[model samples]
Target: MNSEIFSREIIVPQSAIDARGHVNNLVYLEWCLEVAEAHWETKANTDLKKKFAWYVLHHSIDYKASVFEGEQLKVETWIANYKGAKCERLYKIIRLTDQKIIIEAKTDWCLVNANTLRPSKITEEISTLFV
Candidate 1:
């Protein structure tokens, strides 16, 4: 994999917030999924339409600011590295209200065979495009 930025606009909702009155940690991950899926389907147009499956192997996040509901934000993600069948991606959540960074995350994902559920390589068509 390689580092290339992809951006998506997001609208935060009440459900995305925690009792502390800010966006929850897990909700940032949900944004990652939303933006990443769009990046894959609309931009890359890869194996997502077929019956391929992607599973998160690991995730790490660092919170820098309090993000509240009803806010417009931009999420940026990019491939950071890869090995075998695993790809590492980095994410940044920036609040448009103030251009302040609210969160950052790193995710490790692996493609799995839809039928066998065993690890599988991302199709060459997909991998080649990330390079």
Candidate 2:
């Protein structure tokens, strides 16, 4: 386990399952956003969050295995890199029962001014949290 990673636990809900009887593709992305939001809220200060906000620029997910309803999952995420106003966040969704990786994903996020919604630099205060 990486010391820099932030982790969260989730349960597969029946509503998240598709007609194919497995978690839907979109649901995986939702989980990624959920965990990321949780991480930010927990780690970032109110003043920083009030000054800047993040917007997703891109998301890439590789489905390695299927997850079903009632299954427990561990979502581990960390900042892979940051440049200018953008950062790449990495994620791994593991099925706790067998300890298998169900999904591997990365999302590109850009920092933006909370009020103006324009691209903003990654400030030291924000960067230190991920580091």
lDDT of 1 by residue, 1-131 (tens): 45579898888889998989988888888898888777667655544546566679998999998888899999998888776778888899999979999889988999777677788886676666555
Instruction: Compute each candidate's TM-score over C-alphas.
Output: 0.85, 0.96
lDDT of each: 0.81, 0.92
lDDT for each residue of candidate 2 in 1-131, tens digit (9 for 90 to 100): 12289999988989999999999999999999999988999998889889989999999999999999999999989998888899899999999999999999999999999999999998777888976
lDDT of 2 at 112: 98
Candidate 1: stretches off by over 4 Å? 44-48
Off by over 4 Å in 2: 1-3
